[model samples]
Target: MVIAIGFEGSANKIGIGIIRDGEVLANVRKTYITPPGSGFLPKETAEHHRNQVLGLIREALDVSKIYPNEIDVVCYTKGPGMAPPLLAVAIVARTIAQLWNKPILGVNHCIGHIEMGRLITGAQNPTVLYVSGGNTQVIAYSNKRYRIFGETIDIAIGNCLDRFARVIKISNDPSPGYNIEQLAKKGKKYYTLPYAVKGMDVSFSGILSEIGRKALPQKATKKRKLDQEDVNELPSHEDLCYSLQETIFAMLVEITERAMAHCGSNEVLIVGGVGCNERLQEMMGIMCEERGAKLFATDERFCIDNGIMIAHAGYEMFRTGTRMKWNDATITQRFRTDEVEINWEVGKV
Candidate 1:
């Protein structure tokens, strides 16, 4: 009965998870609400993390009914996120691990997401479509590593949507994506958006800019104010929403199909924040049905950001003797999934 405590303070969310063996006992999270226009600020996020980590840790431990001294290991997300936030959690976890005479492992964020999908879905050899505010990638497991077959060349899908919402002055109260989806539901995709796909890589800034220009005209002043007024109505919003979802999801389906064709594997798994989108799921389901492939998705628990996945990934790493050197352990904002070297047996597939 190994008690493992996992911490993920990457980007705007702070996650904490407790795992025993392969079971997730408790998962807790805290989100940092960023102001509109300004994105992630490392300094601000770090300050917020410093205050939230202790509380979230205590909550997680209580939920798991595990005492600090009983913990066998403390695992924390090492990188591919904001440096300041990473450092804040790392310092906390490292100190806790040392105090308890327990081993500490530094885990990658992307690998955590990948491993969570594995734990929840029991996917052995599945192609992964990871789309989030920070990342957009199509991955597959091969040779004991999650290989990136295709990804966004510039901005992530979520980022483009968020920026587009901001440009249109949409409400950012609940979530940018949700607001955009709501607006899109009522509006018509009156304008034709660009579909740029260079090989497997995608670019969305062009489409976003184009939409913004039409949604909010510049030189028109009050010339075509009716267009803006019409956009404020529901039908126009729905159409735009439908169009945006259709275009982006279509691109994803196309690339995913290409990856499946290339890898010769029919099983597909979708992960990350955007994976929760109903439209994306429908598109993938329809495409997979046509291609005679299967698409697997994590439920809300494992789909969005959570700490359980971190604990699960950390537990696997610990089991496989994947530990980081004290001095060599460092956080990165650009860690790729394929860079991780795991020792899982290929025959398990």
Candidate 2:
């Protein structure tokens, strides 16, 4: 069996995986935490990646009980991420590949998520809802391409969650998304947040701004401010969280249902970090069941960002002779899934 080492440095996390014949033998992930009171700063993210990537790769190899020389191929995330972080991963993969005298393959980060979902779920031609910190879209396979049928016109759902978490001073926690999800579960959907969708594309910035406006008091006079104690008791934080989730997830479901109708595909698969959202999954499950469509979600291991997806995609590329020169392999923050022609034989489902 040919063993491949996969590297993922798309954003805040550094992940490494070892795969043999498309089977993930080991998956190691390293998360980079920002400083106190800081968000995902590009420079800080890159610097953190430089520190943890090597260790992540080592951990993967160690967990898999495979030496570096045993690997036949090296795969690294190529793009659609922060430039510095992507470059950091590439440098590590390139150096390792050169040292090991193995072929290096670059994989698209978004496609990796979809492909990994496909692998884990054994879904062929499933409509994909790829939601992450950087992206939110409904994708489907047609005419030999993963086409984007629906997406956010402005900020992605994950970004919206991050911003909301920041506003509530919970963005720097161990898992802001998880914290928001927990809070959202606690309260009823009281305030009706805006649900904006144009054609198949949804917009969250307007909804976010609207929620901020509603959350802020109309009057801030000294006398009114003196009633801050009572003011705080008025609006329920959990209610706001619930409403935000309902609006955003309902929009996602609406677009996904529309896409399934347009594409004539009954199967849908959810991928990316935000795909791990329980409420989103439940909503999609209900919609798909009502529409007589199948819905698949990756397990936690496959749901969040990871390196095995890159390795799986790279193996397929390698099998198809999609070799690239050093110059040919460059970072791209706007790479789309439909742009590439994939040969799936190397990646067995």
Candidate 3:
């Protein structure tokens, strides 16, 4: 019977979601899409969140058929995202909490994804592969915390894909990464790219640099301006996209498998924005099938950053007597997944 309202504007997306018990009543979001060849700036993304958050909240509330007073708690992403955007969401969340006189909980963005994935997929004690525009980590619950087994040493996997899409001038309507995924399906050639994996951690900046030098030469990028017809001498964007996905996803799967083996866990849960990628899921499924394990994932509705995740995670904490004081209701840009205190028992499922 716990009803919670969650606000999430950690990056470019502003999401307001209402959840009752473990089910998502409403999940509404709006993304700020920059033009092709440009990345979303934090300031602009924050402004977009500021402008659209109230409307999204109303939409979520209406869709859920719930009133503000009925909400037992209010939750918002506290960190592991861009500072300005996180702050914008935090402000709105605090305001609404005050107006409704409800308890507030600050949830970790990454853990929200993990908890939401578990709730939807019903995977208990699974090894989590969290991949997103801002984060890439292999995690598992240990010692009452989601410990990171592996992570990206440099830029995130999704950031690398997005930047590559910008270099190729892919459409940013649905998502730059989604556009790359579509083009990758048409790719027949497997152009080799750097596959970086140092122990459990991975690196993508080197691969991005190498691809920029080879498939997208500086001279060609400037002269042809990413025009597929004009850049006939270079490798096709499809090939680059395909190769990038193959290499990076292989690195992710390798680390996830290693973590699963180390933790003695057979269930694998993939969460976060990049978890929406079908190819990644297929690859993970293949690995899981070979290992006689199961893979858990969700569609884009729950995979990407959204408030339902925050609300779900927060409701769990709230149910366990975890509440954020008004003074402690703050946001951070570097909140790691392992930093949060898990109040609930881990073996519930």
- Which candidate gets the maximum lDDT versus the true structure? 3
Flag the better candidate by TM-score, 2 or 3: 3
What order do candidates take by lDDT, descending?
Answer: 3, 2, 1
Q: Which regions of candidate 1 are displaced past 4 Å?
A: 35-38, 187-190, 220-235, 346-349
| lDDT on C-alpha atoms for all candidate structures | 0.80, 0.82, 0.91
Error of 1 at 324 (Å): 2.0
Q: What TM-score would each prediction reach against the true structure?
A: 0.91, 0.93, 0.96
Candidate 1 C-alpha error for residue 203, in Å: 1.0
Candidate 2 structure quality by residue, lDDT tens digits, 183-235: 88997757877779899999999998988766666665566563667577556
| TM-score leader | 3
Error (Å) of candidate 3 at residue 232 is 2.1
Query: In candidate 3, what are the lDDT values of residues 1-349, reduced to their tens digit?
Result: 8999999999999898899988789999999999999999999999999999878988998899999989999999999899999998999999999999999999999989999999999998999999999999999998889999999999999999999888778888899989999999998999788889999999999999888776665665344565656467788888888888999999999999999999888899999989999999999999999999999999999998998999999999999999777999999889989998898877533
Q: Regarding lDDT, does 2 or 3 come out ahead?
A: 3
lDDT per residue (tens digit) for residues 1-349 in model 1: 6777888887777889999887889999887876665555889989998898888988998899989888777888887777888888889888888788888888888888888887777776888999888899999877778889999988999889888777666665556776776665666555567988879988888888777776554544655545655545433445666677778888999999999999988788899878878778888999899989888887657776777777878888888777777775567777778888877543244
* Ranking of models by TM-score: 3, 2, 1
